[model samples]
Target: MVKYNLEPSESILIQSTGVCEGSGLMTAFTDELILTNMNIIHVSKGLFGNTKSVRKYPLNQVKIINGEAQASMGKSTNGIPNLQIYFTNGQLSFKFQSSAKKEIVKYVNGISKVLIGRESNLVANQFAIPGAEIVAETLKDTIGVFKGTLGIKSKGKAADEPVKATKKCIGCMSPLTGTKGQSIRCSYCDTDQIL
Candidate 1:
């Protein structure tokens, strides 16, 4: 039950305990990985449950390499999934139990989302296209006005010209029954055309 001191606006996203790979000559140790909105903290505890060391890696400075399937040219030594965080100066690798596969995947996904959001400055459904609807409505109204002024019908046969049954729809190539110079809307694809 280690207590964490988080900065303002920082929140913990995920926490897991696993075997952390050590550098050359150093033996592996059980470490607790705490992922937060701002950083990932690795806490190494002693036998008496006392914290021996703590390392913090800022989210912006690190790149996460997920399990073998997701990492490019990655391979698992013992079939157990590994999560590696690579930073500018060094890297950290942690191997978790097979049963924690789902949790590891979810944690990696969350981190990826955070990293993407930081890079793009946008999130899913964060903004609305209010102008899109207005633009569409205005275009519709303008088209209607133009059609009325120019004596253009969306779908009808010309009153003076003889019907040409050989004319086909440009969209679907289906035979159309309309006079030459008449604007017709295809029944199959609803495409507006002049036969």
Candidate 2:
């Protein structure tokens, strides 16, 4: 088993190609250090609440048993082997022990920033989301993994406005945050429509 230790002052991104079982985008997070078995379908499929329609693969659950991450990603009776996820101290790490030569990058606070331009080469077209791409590149050039801490970068400036629902005129997507008191003016789209 190959393990990469990460800390608060650093971040690691690994090629998630074979890490997740299903086809759509797959990303996982944990605190750090402690391994957690994951049920790949548990996120979208309702194991706790309600079950949705089954898709291409009907995986129900996964668990880490004695150094192996077993997953049921298909109709097979036997579980497939995969890496276990480590979580502790608000930090998350991934372990991969496969023949696939996919890369994982580790980054620390002052030492490096994920080069977005470099990620353009690694992940497939569909896997390229805003945050996922950043993680992928960071793991590519991980000089060393830090322990007991995690390094995080602020993505963007936080907006002061609290996110509230706006009742649009059912036509245009406009702000109606203050439309409750007055039916006189929309001041938004200028539409006289009332919710």
Candidate 3:
């Protein structure tokens, strides 16, 4: 995957939707935050724990523009919801949504640390989730905490090779190789000037 750099003024957007309990409606949360120089945005406790109303909160150097802070409950078993979060700044974001309330909290807190660039005990923290513990443990073994995962064939540096181009001949307009002093030869045609 290709990674791009994000400008300092770029915004982070989180759009999360999940099903609540005993209700058939699917609830979603869409939030956008812009990072300032040194400002701090604090989210109240109720903003995450309870899904009463749509709320917006701010963290240090980040602002929340919009958020739908409610969970949807389903009357049937097919009412489970999946939440998705998108990070615009060359990084993928993760959101938490589960039938178990405790698992939801743990997933949120674990991913929050990763977003803020903090030390993580992600393995221990994600054990409660169904398959998250195995995935996290696999990641821990393969890529560790700081470094990202590499493919099986990728052994060393994965930097791309630089591209090069040369000038063309003024006479035939063909492509030329080498420099002025080294050799004046055109690779496209058999033309030599000052070899």
Winning candidate number (lDDT): 1
Better of 2 and 3 by TM-score: 3
For candidate 2, give the lDDT of residue 3. 36
Could you give the candidate ranking by TM-score, starting with the highest? 1, 3, 2
Q: If scored against the real structure, what TM-score would every candidate get?
A: 0.49, 0.15, 0.21
Q: What are the lDDT scores of the predictions, listed in order?
A: 0.63, 0.30, 0.36
Q: Which of the numbered candidates is closest to the native, going by highest TM-score?
A: 1
Task: State model 1's lDDT.
Answer: 0.63
The sequence of per-residue lDDT tens digits that candidate 2 reaches over residues 88-153 is 222122332243223232211101112111222212332347697678878744622432135543
lDDT string for model 3 (42-106, tens) is 12123255423332233332211233112211123343322222233221222224443343443
